[model samples]
Target: MEQTYIKKILKTRVYEVAKKTPLDYATNLSRRFNNHIWIKREDLQPVFSFKLRGAYNKMANLSEDILAKGVIAASAGNHAQGVALSAAKLKIPATIVMPKTTPEIKVAAVQSWGAEVVLHGTTYDDASKYAQQLVEQQGLSYIHPYDDEDVIAGQGTIGMEILHEHSGKLDAIFVPVGGGGLIAGVATYIKYLRPEVKVIGVEPDDAGCLHAALKAQERVILDQVGIFADGVAVRQVGKLPFEIARTHVDEVLLVNTDEICAAIKDIFEETRTITEPAGALALAGLKQFIARENCNGCHLITIASGANMNFDRLGYVTERTEIGEKREALMAVTIPERLGSFRQFCHAVGQHFITEFNYRYADDEKAYLFVGVRLNDGLEKDRLIAKLRDKEYPVIDMTDNEMAKSHIRHMVGGHTQSLANERLYRFEFPERPGALLHFLTRMGQRWNISLFHYRNHGAAYGRILVGIQVPDEQLNELQNFLENLGYPYWGEANNPAYQLFLN
Candidate 1:
């Protein structure tokens, strides 16, 4: 079976539209890790993504009769642009169905390529169903994004090129996986030719479809997936790609959104090019792998998968990169409300850069201060906390606290005594013009909103921290309301940060 892919990959027709991107050595990354780290520049392709290779190859293989009938595809973003450009090059009609929640930048890119864009439901699965229905009704051929043999073979060209460039020197190749097409193709080809080299798949921790499927020994659909790395947020791995990945991929690594953001910063520092979260996934995994294995002086390669980043998202990425890299520590400190207290706290912090400092005088005896200090690493944070403890200053580390990082840091004010039976919850929902209004309407004046904080981070989703007052007897009713709200939410009532500043 591996030999079959080997043969197919050798004959792939991706060259018609796809370029043989260079394998560029990352001198800075290599030096930092003490390993020879190289990046496969799939991001340099004309379409700014490797999806063009597979999309073009699959379209090229279709018969003239079938091509004349046109092709259709469903994608969140990258694949839609790939199919649209491929169809434009081949002078064939193409229709792309994309989720209505797709970023506006991506939707515009698909339209710019002259394809018929059909905005469908909220997720890829919904758009896929609509696209399949169109195939039967409109007499069009459907081009599966990652499930087809031809497409996998096309993506295999990257593996072939990597080997041709590096030969047998590479220790491992890290591939970003959504539905497993890229890793399936690369692993199949590499294992058949040079079985010694490892092929690893990387995924966002919140959207680890391939990792989950490989662990279960069969396909398993995720109940929910995070949208930060929207490009690779698939609920389920493709049937064929999952089978190949299960056999060939040596390991699967999961990286968090913050890690991905740090990787994007790493790439930008080296190349002056910002990558989307999914695009930086392989590098994020590579860093984690190097740390876990204590690998050094080894040759490693990771694919820079795509560069179709939304310009507005860079702010959110920058906000998390410092914490991701362990260069900053967020903390909450309680000090006596005295004239010399502020100076004492600053003296305790020493010469470390103060990135942020927020304090509001609440009580006559004590006050809580939300602060951020530059740190050399995680160990430095611990030492600082120890010093503060010796000085009898109560401190709570907020670096890893999601609520503290996302909302509470920006909101530090006097607590209200009039609000009784208050419960706090953080929610994430699709960001649209009337989305907040719709949510308020759904609440239907059942409970009073005691506290609320929201800021647009220019992401596809909106995050909000809401405090609602509900009696103990209405706990079941609150659960029912959240279930029907159709939005992801987490209770923060027990969070120390909330108790310290808001309660």
Candidate 2:
């Protein structure tokens, strides 16, 4: 099996459309981690992602008759651009079915390649179903994003290039896993040649299909996947890729949204380039592995996967970077509702930089203060909390509190004493134009909105927190309404942060 894939990868003509991306040395990261870090610059590909290699390879291997009938693909963004460009290069008709919620820039990029863009549904799965229908109806050839063998072989060329570029002692190579094609392909070639070199796979914790599959010893579908790293937000690993991964891929590591954000900043500091969350995934894993293993002066590599980032999303990434790096901490501190009490609390927090402070008077005796403190190290947060406690100030660590970080911090003083029967929810609203208005229309003024907080993070989706008043008798109606609304939501009525800062 290894020999067959190795031969196929070596013979693949990915170079017709995909360039051999350079393996770059991250000097800053290398020095900080005490390891020689090499980054595979797949983001520099013409289509700005490694998807071009697989997309083109799949199309190129097609029979002349199939090519004449045109090709079709479904993608949220990156793969769509890859297929569109490949079709243009081959002068064949191409139809790309993309999610309606895909970023505008990506839709334009695909259209720029002369491929017909069909904005079909709200998710990649929906678009894929429509694409399959079109494939059968139009007699068009389907180019899968990551499943087919030809596609995997094309991706395997990256492994071939990596071995050719760095002849030194490479300790490990980290690859980001979506549907597992990249890892499967790279692991196959690397294991076949340099059997000692480890091939690690990285994935976001919320969308770790490959990790879940490996643990189950079979392919398994995830109930839901977080779309923060939309490029790699797959719910299931492809069957072929999972089979390869079960045997070749060394291990899978999971990183959270904040860790992924920190990695994006790290990549920018080194390469002066901002990568999407999924692009920075491998480097994030590499850093975690280095810290866990306490290895020094060893050669490590991570693939910088893609650069098609939404400019609007950078603000959110910047906000989370410090927290992700464990250099910042958030807390809810309670003190006497008097001037001298604040002064005493400030003295307790002496010399520590305050990144944010929010205080609101709930009564004449006590006050709730939401504070963000910059920490020199992760342990400093504990020290600061201890100091505050010694001063008789009640403090709650809000650093890992999702409600505080996402919504409560933004609306700290929105407590209402007169409102009743209000329930809180966090929703992922599609970021398309009029989406909010559409949500309002669906809500239909049936229930009174007690509290609403929305701040655009500039991705394909909006993080929204809403408080709706529903009488006890209308609980079933509210549940039915949310289910019919069709957006991912979580109830936060009993969230500790909500109780501390808002309730």
Candidate 3:
């Protein structure tokens, strides 16, 4: 059978790759899943992903005539590095076309593999179209990222290696889906050798084109893809790989940005390895499935496919980790007509830091405010709900909803006030210090500060507004204290009077 012959080549490739990589068991995940979970350590591949398997296999099998013509590929991640390293090894010049938005880290890593990197267009489709044109004009052999048979066979070798290394008892293999070459190759080999071994594909929820296509029984194109998992945010999966997946893959799961961030942080904390969001998708999917289905007492293997992470992106990953774990509570607080009511509301919130606060009174009636609080670590959502219900406050949890997190956090307030004249204050403090109360208590006048606003908004310090009646001369003493307090202070008393009337 053609499949049998291909498996033979995959067998040889598997032997070679196993000699090159480590089959390190992931103790943290294993303990949590109650299964002997192991990482293929493809991230430890010479090119930082399993992509080298396919690239080298394809190049090694190339005819002398084709080798002389060189090779080209369009990839924004592992495939680029794989092709670069493989072509360099085979002494074949390679040109890689990548999406313009590909991370600098990936681009630099691919270049380091000795391939010429051409950054073009905004998506993989754009670069891939350009690559096709180059194949015709430049007479270069175009290496389909995952569409070709050889590339799939090469990726299959990783599956062969897994069976050999893991005592031949893998319950399932989790693979991250992109162009689908990696999973296709892997799934084909997995099905041929161990038909029952589940091959699950993980995809970004924002770019689950493959899963969408599988459901539709045809190719589907996404109009927009999330760039957070830039490496695997493919708008569509390859036709050939899709065929292989439709037949052999057991399931495909979609993970959102928060889940991917949680997986990335989990790996970093447990193994001290940082992976790109796409690389973490498989683990995120596994965690979701395990939680929803109780996948305990079963062996699972995850391919931490790549690690070419940009240093700057780590901050966003860390910031979203809380959101992923549901440890940050975001809400819009609506306050009614009363003076000590604001003070009572403050007292009502127990054991939480006000991470963000914004306030404005549209009319004389009600003030709309945005409030975010840092939940105590390990607090249960039900307890949080109960705590909020016990108080005379309305708390709607937007932690799990992405639409709410991005847009709602911005538009959470609406105007309910009819009276206008509100005051604004611009206060600047050192990057630190008890800036809020320190400024508030220093005012020395109880002008009934009507509105307040602040966002723990990652600024050098912070900004807030206090709608207290403008005490023209009292500001001098206030300004004196702020200046002596070693921070910049500006009185916004000159704020345009009518700006307040517009709500």
> Candidate 3 versus the native: TM-score?
0.76
Which residue pairs in candidate 1 collide? none
lDDT of 1 by residue, 340-385 (tens): 9999999989999999998887779998999999998758999998
Model 2 scores a C-alpha lDDT of: 0.91
Clashing residue pair totals per candidate (backbone < 3 A): 0, 0, 5
Once fitted onto the true fold, the runs of candidate 3 whose alpha carbons sit more than 4 angstroms away are 1-19, 33-35, 352-364, 373-379, 386-390, 401-503
Sort by lDDT, top down from the best: 2, 1, 3
- What TM-score, to 2 decimals, does candidate 1 have? 0.97
Candidate 2 Cα deviation (angstroms), residue 182: 0.7
TM-score of each: 0.97, 0.98, 0.76
Candidate 1 vs candidate 3: the TM-score winner is 1
Can you tell me which runs of candidate 1 are displaced by over 4 Å? none
> Local error of candidate 1 at 199, Å?
1.3
lDDT values for all models? 0.90, 0.91, 0.72
Per-residue lDDT of 69-112 in model 3, one digit per residue for the tens?
98999987878888888877778799999876565677888898
Question: In lDDT terms, which candidate is top?
Answer: 2
